[model samples]
Target: MHLRFHALATACACLFIAPTLRAQTTSPTLVTATTNDTSAEQVVVTATRGAKAVEKIPGAVSIISRQDIEAQGLVSEDPSALLALQIPGYAPSRQKLSNFGEGLRGRNALLLLDGIPQTNPLRLGGREGYFADPMIVSRIEVVSGASAAQGLGATGGIINTITRTPTEEGTRHTVELKYGTQFHGDSASWKTGYMLEHKSSYDLIAYLGARNQDIGVDGAGRPLATESLHRAADVFVKLGKDFGPQRLQVMFNRYQADGFDDRVDVPGDRATGVPTTSQRGTLPYDAPRNEVRSASLEWTHNDLAQGTATVQLFKQDFSARYSGGVIATFQDAAIAPVGQLIDQSEIQADKWGLRASWVRPDLWTRGLELTLGADYLDDESQQRLTQTGRVWVPPMTYRSLAPFAQLEYEIGPLTLRGGLRNEHSRLKVDDYSTLAYYGSRAVQGGERSASKLVKNLGAVWRFGNTGWSTFAAYSEGFGSPDVGLILRAVNSNGRSVNNLVDLQPILIDNREVGVTWRGSRASLSASVYRSHSDLGSQLVVSNGIGSVQRVPITVRGFEVTGEWRPLPDWQFNGSYAITRGRTASTAGGSLDLDLGARSQGPDKLVLGALWRPAPGWQAHWTQSVYFSRDANEGKFSGRTSLEEHFKGYTVADVALSWDSPWGKLGAGIENLFDRRYITYYGQANYSGTAEDYYAGRGRTLTLSWRRTF
Candidate 1:
């Protein structure tokens, strides 16, 4: 059911499929070094590990700078709230406190800090970059499709967050303090970020933050959700030493986050008491505790003569504890329930990886470049259940190795880029023991060597002085199945897996292309993309007893995005996405189940814009209108269903900011019109359907202050 060593071996073999490249360009110069402080906003990244203005990258991409963040009052709380309004298809819920945890609020976008991956394969669809710092961000780079060089998990796209780099060119110190309000509780956050550098070759940057919010109840008259408290810190240091014909630099970074969303379910309420959101539920709350930590180090050398070589080592861990579920009579009482009342489940893991890359510039022709890299990863996980205060583990390990290459060339006004990658992945189950009454499991232990192949090609042509550029790109990426999920579920811990059939790796292939036109008066960038996945992990069914299953299906969709800046202060941008998914096979196969459960969703779309008529003042706004009727599994067909098929709704938001000599001041209102909507839905337990709807907050105000010395 899981991808194993086969994937690794196959991917490694693919390294020889491509031809050599010839190109030249030594170091990535500073953005400020090439600009006169004007048009710094047009710098491009990710297309190359370096900088090139957007006009030069051969594919579709977008940028959201630090200026955009501050002017939009993104200084405190739910940073995802803003990204949801920006990236197309990337969805993060606006409501902080909810039953199924944070649902997709903003973009479904894959997020990165420096060069580390923060996506969670186990918990599909929930974006985790919400915990990052926008205050210290140098620039936000968004590449619209799968690029073999960007690593795995980019079926949707890539959002790489580049932190500020300290340089002797400028000296600056900044800090921000902010307080905000929703319909109920008061929220506040403090951030301190610094960049230090001298004319010397050494530079360092750091960011630390602490934020808190007391939650309130939903309109259902149940306890409002309150996420306990959180504290996070990130630090990075770079030491660059110059050597004859080459520059060597060493870099290191560390990050940590911890908190809990404690939801007290009001099981009982005063009969005569007004049915306020808080009075809806009186059951004891279900509180979840979780934490994420990561560390990475890298070394780079540009003049290997043969090419540029870089190597890195990293460790990442994510752990969580769930301790508040309603008491349930054992679904299967054949065996003593260890005392009857059942409560809770958890996911604990550890991952370590190493990466090495080499890039050769122009071995044969001018304007030709080639890059080669490989990654090795080891993942370990433990799944446990609490029975009358007892804990059990159905442990497992998942590992993978991948190597890739890319080539790029330019002739006159035409530029083209192409690349490919192969991943060899392996999975194994260890110390797996116990119970048959509950179900079918991975045969004590087994291995799978599922290899995946990724490829990309892009080209762009500039039409002289007319100010028009033609662009198009084709790329592929795969969405992999969670090996750890398979190990635990089959071991009798999660339901369906107990008496179920078989499991297989879900696979997805994605493709995209686009074009753009810009002139002195206006500019527009538009592109369309589509993705298809077979053996896809689709939610099959879940019985209230905390058991669930997935069937291999086909999920495919198309999307288009556009933005036009008519004036220095006026810009309009928006994106639209639609997905059509269904079971690929049902008649005959190793996997079979009525799974009457439908897995699909209505098409999704959003439109918004940023307007800044002057330097000291800026206004930003956006709206999202859903077409939920297109959704599947009868998610909105229940009691709390706001609308059959989650009737599409529209909401507005606006932000204004002013820069003063003393500092920068800003304010904004989200869901300005108080419209209600669901960003994402579905859960593995309790409600077998996508019943988990994350609420969109009503009108809320945010304020911020920042100063630099």
Candidate 2:
């Protein structure tokens, strides 16, 4: 059902109950930073916008600590690649500049920086995973399910990255240096960074880092096609001051990655099974690049009306430029001929948001708590043809206001929680004309508005003194489709924004049940879940234009995770996940069609081990395996056709580290066997083009050193 302003007002009216509750001895817990300790009581703030332990949450949530990041960074610096091996139900990593086909739980996952959304949902650029360098990150929190906790674009789940903050009492200086190479061709990379942290009456942190990479060679001694010969850098700073029961913090970060113009793509032959490669040559246009600048200011008060209140104001400016190509839609009569024009697409967007929340524990009674919050976002975005300065996708403005209330009640061994969120979003577009290739149709524009009232209910029951618990959860998420693509795909006359069916937002419903057990030296967790959407959004690009196809979709999956510590110096962990999905055929009349690889990925398994051979010496190993899948049913057409067959592949990595008196020295080996195989994306997304097929990376060795003073 649709919710209006009056409903939101009514929801906020419950805040009146805040005045009756008395302030207790225990103040609201705040998870402002992450630590290396693996404590069971470690808190997470992404799930409910408040501090809550992972075991207490009623659904699957993963926390990748600093130690985990450091170990994984030895093999790869890409966050998407790290998540692909660590998180269950997450799709395989493309290992490219864009996270094009990486879906979580067979659906889109939202990326956040300290609770600020980094995804450009209006355009679907697929570049959110590379916003900042992993060196500056303290930890990552993943919530696996369709959740409306942080507002729109969370159909699959949420990945919130927490940045490093000042921890020590005095000023500290640190320097880091790392280098890696495949030892084949010119496949070498290096990174250097410096950081400073200070704390006393006020806290301050600053970091600067830069990374450069040469061409990457696959196991077959061939250079990969994308993200080669690139330079990336970032600058981050944070300042905070505490004033009795309140605190204020300000954070800023700027990141940029630019590709060199010294390489050219060598398309692969799908029929001949030849993978795409690259060689030294001059590019037709400027190389692809990404640039982003973000800042946020937050204020927290612990004694506000006998409750804890948090308010944040944030803004971000982002732009992404893609490779140039001679496509039909880019052929502007006023600029160049249809067959001679080479143009690139660049997306530019600006976002501003305000978030406010209040947590009142022990509201009226013990073990009873309430949380009230609201979020406001304003985003304006557009795409343009860089060469001709022509507006390829007209400017569009999106604004959303969501108000929510969450309640938790605990009784002995049972904990129950429920939340309701009302979202009101509006899109505004001005009248615009299509390109000549699309008949240059004249389309009228108007404002389109949508409202939804989503709900989440969950419960967790712990067995008496035993370390076992069972939980169940049902949640809903709300989000809009790619409005820019829909707006640009209108090739017919007499069309308005409000009348387009493709503009409707998707509402996903998810249900899950799980069990967990924690022993003195071992722990295990498992869950099964099902999620569906009556109307789903899928985009397909043809002739240099994207078209949105709306259909019904259903996805089901199960995940198992376990860890065992048999000895004080030895530990082992593993996880497995299986995901499958179906959608209504876009060919019309067909039903229950299998989703293609672009929409869903195959099963995944990961195993890891940690060993401490002696004092200050340790080693870590990880193995990732993807199972084979054959969805080659029906005809190959867009997202509905499951015409690709994916062959399974396995990769292994190892890291060794030693703590010396001067610093910590580390070494790692990726692809220890150097087994030659095609990547999951290359094999599963067979588009009959040489540029689409790619080989996985070859064996590589990395060395790193870090010191603090």
Candidate 3:
């Protein structure tokens, strides 16, 4: 059946492009810088390991420009929310600082900062998405689905946050201030930031920035204790020099957030799934503290070995303390007779790596390009109890070396791309004792190593002069379970980690077909994909503790997006996504079971319009819709076992901006109708009954001003 579907989809795509094949022999004109042209050329680096036009890439890719970022006025500190809003197949935001279950294409995605990995795959804390502030970001690039271009943790795809760089040869300064508050309540917050850039005539540039923000409350006028408090300050600096044939750049960033809230959650009614809440009181745990520090140096040499060669070295240190929660209950011999809840777990990670790549276009053949790269990474991570200083996840170190190559060949109207990556990694862990659940469990750690070769193949057919293109791709992705978690919780008496052969790496196969049409006033794209894994890892939460469960599963989805410009000053855009998944079960002689909310989310739709009625004045509005979903969890076998029947909902947002001599003034309202709604995760798979389930914030009004000199 899967093969039949793939063939049909491919045939349909080819049929759509057949009309324009005759124009393939003619030379195509490259789009130049023109103000009147609505379509602007975009270059992407992550998709192909080198700078390439977005339209030429044979994959699901989206670019969120700087202008788009400013226009959205995203309130959530996690940029994942921004991606969810713009890109299809991205799960909806959980509204928390964490990205626990935020999967792309139903799998883990790699997070990158200037081509450096930010994820701690060995520990798998799920906080890699929020490493930096969006203010310093120049643009965001997203590539959906599996590919060999990136090494580990890219079972889903890659998201690279490109930082701003100096453009002109002059000194420039900018400052921004923003204030926000609930419409019907006094949950107010403010943020301030400043940036300085100096570009010298001698091909040298320096950039620096600093920002600070305060904590805020929720829509219900309740302090957001569990939600990531924003008492944070961040600073970044960059220095660059260009010496005609070679260029060098160095960057450093530091961010810290710490705050204490007097609040706790009490369990509410379980039948209705109502959450618990608290007015005021400090919990018996340490305050939340999150710190991230990073540094990188990059060098680029042109015409090295008849190609462009680039090398980068980077290091990152990250530590985060989560709020107190009822993770586990264990009894102490001298402290208590009965088991008590142990709250607070902190994660610390250090990562450093070196990456080098060379790109040579038209190497020995016309319309053929070759790119080769090698990467080396060393990561150390550990998780501990902040209260008693007891290890939860034992310290683990990972070393990886990967070599990859990609080739692109263009012939007539069709472009073919293929790549291969060899991944070799070694993980080492020392012996450690586990926390006392019923009793202290001893774990014997050891070393494990794995090597895999993944491949990707794709083809894009462009209908010359028609502004239409279609692509088909097949790729493979690889992922490993959180070894530390598995090794630390060994309950089997006298079992060593090395003896546990059940924990094996998972590989996923992805197939996709897509079509895109771009005209003078309209653009549309549609894609269908299927991804399957014989051995897939699913996060299972029981009694507030999460663990991985391996299962055979298949996921299929489709996405459609369109944009139209009815008038020169007015534009409308929309997108829709539908995803369905199933897993194999051995309940009664191997049955295909429906994946619940814990593994899959509901369908999503977004519609918006932007209008610039007058010069320097802009207005925008957006509506987001989540369709209902009901999937049964066979374990429970009742209404409660259904994992919260998600109901459909629609939310609206509006914003306006105006240019002024002093600065640019902006005002916006989120949740325009103040319609209270439950978040998708909250409704489907919220682990705790006491904490406020994922409830959408109430109406919020934001005012901001910015100036540049």
Poorest lDDT segment (10 consecutive residues) of candidate 1: 18-27
lDDT tens digits by residue: candidate 3, 561-592: 66666678877777666777777543112325
Candidate 3 residues lying further than 4 Å off, grouped into runs, are 1-40, 74-78, 183-186, 201-225, 325-327, 334-342, 543-545, 585-591, 633-642, 686-688
Better of 1 and 3 by lDDT: 3
lDDT per residue as tens, model 1, 1-709? 0112332342233223111100001001111110113242366646565445666666556566666555545423455655555544444343442222221111124566666666655443232544355655766677655455565556556777776666544455667776666645433334445544433444455555554444433333133333333445555555555565455555455544444443332322222322212222332433455555666676767678668777777777765555444334222344455454445655566777887777787859988888778878787766454443332345556677888888878788788888888877766654453333335332345554568777777777878766566776777665555444444444444333222233344444555454454444333343444454444444332343322334444333444444445556665655554444344323233322211212333344565565666767666666665554422343321243211233455666777777878787878776676554433432112142322333444566677777866
For all candidates, what are the clash counts?
58, 1, 0
Model 2 lDDT on a 0 to 1 scale? 0.80
- In angstroms, the error of model 3 at 695 is 1.7
Q: How does candidate 3 score on lDDT?
A: 0.71
Task: Please list the C-alpha lDDT of all candidates, in the order they appear.
Answer: 0.50, 0.80, 0.71
Q: What is the lDDT of residue 353 in candidate 3?
A: 94
